[model samples]
Target: MFICPYCARNFYRAPKFRAVSHIRFLNASPNSPAIDVYLNDRLMFRNLLYKYFSDYVTIPSGTYHIKVFPSGNTVNPLIDKSLFIPPEKIFTLAAINEYPNMDLLSIEDVRHPKIPDKAFIRFGHLSPEAPTLNVVLPNGNTLFSNVSYKQITPYIPVDPGTYTIEARSSSSDERILYVPNIRLRGDRFYTIYAVGNLSKPPELQVLIPLDGNSYIGS
Candidate 1:
């Protein structure tokens, strides 16, 4: 068991965990309760979240491709099976629903370098029925002021580099949404679409190949 240095809480395992797939689902209403869960065409758990209306599945340690679909919703399933991974250690999966009041959408210009000659940023969300978009640069500066939106925006732009974007209710008191660890690169454009809610937090994914090769970063 390990204890959190900050929270002083004991954990059965350390933070350096491995391949165990954790799956979660929320708001299991009649239309979507105990939905069917799958890991790469294999049925691992069924109605996993039916009784408590919330479900979680822990798969054996390894890498896996995951797929999620509603019971008998073959015509129009909710989640498509994608990549699911379980490292050599243990990890917990927590699934929750989106706060209907807000949805977050943002993307950076992918083709251009981190900083382009001309940049355009795009952000979108659904909630507070029309709120202002607030963008803060890594330098602790404001690029765009409180710009109100008519509908969910498609995108916006900044000078370049890293930044944080948030949605504030018209009054700027309540935070509607937040997007962090957003790194704008000169290579490709990044776009995010949050439906109902985000399946997972925005991730800074790094793909490393198994082939024996050394990577030297700047």
Candidate 2:
């Protein structure tokens, strides 16, 4: 004769009630392989290890329905999750937030330049791996390559005066955007800005104003 819900035992000879656990990774799924432990839906423990499945459950104190799955893959099959066992307590779960590699390249604007232009060079990058965009010419000779995130260059023919344009980065956390030294007038009209590795760095703006003043016929 035996009964024990919480010390309601009529045990003629008692000694059998066990439940213990300890899981400390705190942030799972580095690349899941095996994890499944359930009870009351039946199928308790299958390939478990925070480091040794806690020696075969016996969690007695009331309240057990722990489920976790993702363990068997020829391709994929086995996925579920649940946990709550308070009796001789020892459970920890905290880990989820992974996905920040990086990719956001952009350089959109630079169409048909050939008319008194003094400054108009804009390029962008955040990630494309094999990336290179070097355009330097005060008269040292250098024009770059592997470029195609949205390439455009129509007025890089400087020789009217005032110039200092430099956009350089070959990859791995690259960012460039500088403006405030341009005056290579011929037909007149200018704009220069560079910034893109996700955002926030491209603001030297001036779509056409070397200070000649205009509302375009006003």
Candidate 3:
């Protein structure tokens, strides 16, 4: 008795759920070990590496204890905390910083006020070594500025077309990444993540995209 907007398919039975929410995990720590995510003492995600983002998983809305441990080890947890999830919402949980100084940043993902014939996007700063950044368009307009590590911006709408996105250092105007010819389709949503460590051999930063429709019930 429900229709899937992404697939445009109708289902005879209502999707299983009473109160539900979606959650995605992002590993932003540059030097942290591969991690395992647990919900209520049960393993939920295994072997999530640095700079990786996991697809959204649906869960019933409630308060749950969350734990992050080194892969394959449960005796020691890098993070042990409890979080509350409200019904029919989306969230992104990011693990950040080096061990012993590690932390979690919980971001509420809001989808609303969409513009017709436009694409929506948000940017996340995950590169530990990178300085505060500025996201600029070819026309010299800035979309996001002074975004530091572990910072995430609110969604912005743009006309559906090809664009050359430039990431620059906010302090000195130094160019970091030039992502050219990126196309945004109408009515689509996206998250662009700045990834990589500045001290690493590949000094160049990388941008990774997570399509909005990756969540099943979104």
Residue 16, candidate 2: Cα error in Å is 78
Q: Candidate 1 — what's its lDDT?
A: 0.35
- Per-residue lDDT tens digits for candidate 3, residues 44-138, read 77898776667667778889899998999998688888999888787778887655466787877776655789888888887777899999987
lDDT of all predictions: 0.35, 0.33, 0.73
lDDT of 1 by residue, 1-218 (tens): 10101111222322345433333322212113455555567765455442121223344555455444555444344454444343432221212233221111212112222334433444323222334655454454654445554232334444556556554444554655565655554422333322222223322111111110010111
Task: Report the error of model 2 at residue 53, Å.
Answer: 56
Models 1 onward score TM values of 0.32, 0.17, 0.81
- State in Å the error of residue 21, model 2: 58
Give the per-residue lDDT of model 2 (tens digit) for 1-218: 11101111111221355543322212122223455444455554556432121222234444444344443322222333344544443232322211122111112122343444343333222222223555454454654434443343443444556665454454532434333465545544332322223232222222222211111111
lDDT of the structure predicted as candidate 3? 0.73
Ranking by lDDT: 3, 1, 2
Best by TM-score: 3
